[model samples]
Target chain A: MTCPEELDPVRLLTPRAREVLAAARVVLERDGWDTLTMRSLADELGIAAPSLYKHFASKDALRTQLIALALKEFGEGVRPVSGVAALVRAYRDVAAAHPQLYRLATSGSLDRDALPPGLEDWSGSPFLEATGDPHRAQALWAAAHGMVILELDGRFPTGSAPEATWDELVTHFG
Target chain B: MTCPEELDPVRLLTPRAREVLAAARVVLERDGWDTLTMRSLADELGIAAPSLYKHFASKDALRTQLIALALKEFGEGVRPVSGVAALVRAYRDVAAAHPQLYRLATSGSLDRDALPPGLEDWSGSPFLEATGDPHRAQALWAAAHGMVILELDGRFPTGSAPEATWDELVTHFG
Candidate 1:
């Protein structure tokens, strides 16, 4: 194992930081991002608002950290396969399972430049490799994203199975 | 022109209601959905909060009206032709023009059952007819939505053209 001093600072967060993050997730999942303010998070953790600042510089900082954690959890659940279909399935499952969090990660106001290391690259590169062409992977990812948005929005037509559409997308584009 | 009494009640809204809606759009576009509130809207209009209530029953009511207005405007912009490409282009243009409004119309807290007459049907039926199959249309719509979200969120990689990605989606799926 690497020496403790050599550990990445972010990876070396204090236990209180981890607790703050966990409480933030609960607030996010329960009330959505708009409601997950620093004060609310602190209230949920039974602590003073300023105490959260020690763990997170600001609410936006807390949000970035939460998204990174969510992405990490999502990455872990993704199947260990290079096929395009599996990747789409993994992405869809995560989005469907946590629709609000998915929106926060995908479309929230978090600054992309400030995302934790490996997160943006993870989102960008793997799909490029999966389809063996950047354009194809890009189109495929967009289509998959559209389906998830539709599903979450309840806009999918009655009796239309999204899975079949996913299969068709894979067959036609993958 | 139809008689004033023959028009739908919503269509028969007072000029002040229209003004309220216009101001609400400006607020929504400028400050985003989270910042829009009855008090803020009244402040924008230089009116009392109670007077604004004469036009809208609650915040959710105002949101529903805003979404309905957006959908109507979107419907008017759709090309006369029924091809999938025209439909997607129309949707994309509207989304790009007003990203926040599109998000509100597509995914906000407006109750589907409570949508103004013809709004839900308007969004649901046309795409189905364009693609010539419900399932295909559903998938295509999702892909288009995904592309729009990615574009709005700057998720596309540097040097990649979203329009080209859109063209690729239409060619493969249309």
Candidate 2:
């Protein structure tokens, strides 16, 4: 995932900090959010845990950066689709492509204060642009998110393809 | 919630184990699954952690019980609704009521091997009953789940009521 210069929030960080962010993403995708720790990330980076503190003050701080990366990548993936059905498909594909990052970015309380301004809105503009209504877009986005996350979590019945469900969701809004 | 005699899986447990299960529910809802430990359950029960193991062999074993309990309660809550709109509403209400348990039960790779046979099907029957098609029912369930989880996690924009989103989903499926 090439972070386009304009949309890249990590550019503000020092070059070494950016490397840490890259490594963190690898760790986050390889290991889940719960198991990813400063110690784990340090081991991933071939550095001591104390040195990680210099790059990222804490795990929470490091996580904030990782979320930004996920947002950017997810946003880029989902932004280009033209219609409701296509948008849902793109959303699901992007999420499926990076299930771990998708879960991390979507689940739990988001710390908006720590994120760069408009980054959230810009990341989400594709939904509004597709649906042409904020509420509808949000509903569609929520529905799409729900399908992807449930599929990722294995909540749907075992041995059943979720295509019909996905189609049902798209048929509803499309 | 009163678990119906036939529906209650916990009925298989000994009396003391039932008490421990009840206490475990309280701690799970209060502290969340990650923070929940055998030691914590023991403390909640006023017994030593080692003694708690007498009731359940491992945390995974205990969690399966908790999952059973969640399936029963969620099934009970959602089973009676007659239509897609009402089913979605009831699902959202029940999930909102027990946010922690909803997350615990719904997220992750389910251990079907551990859960009682037919418990999964019985719990999910409401969706099929309401929709009258397995695929459509699964689709509606996934859409509703998407809305509930996003709302629970504060994924929707701050201060948004999400009513329109809910209405949109129901309108699609209904």
Candidate 3:
């Protein structure tokens, strides 16, 4: 899928840096954010930790790149903006497909200063497009996020998806 | 406030164990769950880590106790259940009051088997009491959770509370 230029924060990275980031994503999926150390990432890439640091200064910088990637992919996965149900469905599908990325990008306070300017807003613009009102969009987005997160964490009681819960959310917003 | 018997998971713990859990809460708030260790709790209590282990076998068990306490307090905080607006208000207030504990309790997969039987359900029963339908209740709970978590993490654009978004959530459910 073609990512919008605004959403593609990694576009500024050199080809080798992009490769390091790709490896980082793999490591993040496997080891999670907490365990994704520079050494571990270097080990994954078969490079010395010092060499890896040349590509990305610290794990935090690497994490910022990953969050940008997550935003780009998640934004793409949920757009072009459509009806509330479709948006919610797309949101859940993208997050469910990339649960690790979803949690890493969203679970903590975002380093807005580090992230590319307007990239967060551009990615989240689809929510605005769907609802036409900021508050409603936020509510819808949060509801979808809550459902996706709870579902991913298996916080829901059943083994199966909570289809009815999702439907109720959509019905209210629709 | 009087806690319902089923909701009080810490009730069965020995006096000493309860004191250990109390110390853990202080440490958890001061340092997040990731930083909260047996050593830290023991340090807070002026004891050694071994003493902490005797009270709670591992950090995970201690975490379970914290989750139980969070759920009990959160349950009481949101009740006695009232209208959707009131419930949403109460929910946000309670979570905001204990952001650290709220994140610890709800962020990951719950160890239902390890928890006191029926405590989770009893704590969550307020949602059902408000909505009168399981799916709707789940949706509302998820929405409230989503809003609260995002707010706690300062995910919203403004530092001020997203009152409009929260009202939108309540409007739909109410």
lDDT, each prediction: 0.72, 0.82, 0.85
lDDT of 1 by residue, B17-120 (tens): 98898999999998888888778888999988888888888888888888877766665566354788888888888787998888777773546565555555
Q: DockQ for all models, in order?
A: 0.56, 0.73, 0.84
Docking class of 1: medium
DockQ of 3: 0.84
Candidate 3 lDDT by residue in tens digits, B32-123? 98888777778899998887777887888888889989988888888886778888888888887888999999988778887778778878
Pairs in steric clash, model 1: A146-B142
Q: How high is each candidate's TM-score?
A: 0.86, 0.93, 0.95
- Candidate 3: regions farther than 4 A off: none
lDDT of 3 by residue, A1-174 (tens): 457675588888999999999998998888777788888889998988999878787777877889989988898888885888888888988998888899989888678887878888878888998999999989988888888888777888884447898899999999
Quote model 2's iRMS: 1.3
For candidate 1, give the lDDT of residue A126. 54
Give candidate 1's error at residue A87 in angstroms.
2.0
Candidate 2 has an lDDT of 0.82
| Weakest lDDT window of 10 consecutive positions for candidate 1 chain A | A1-10
Runs with alpha carbons beyond 4 Å of true place in candidate 2? A1-7, B1-7, B159-161
- Model 1 chain B scores worst on lDDT over the 10 consecutive residues at B1-10
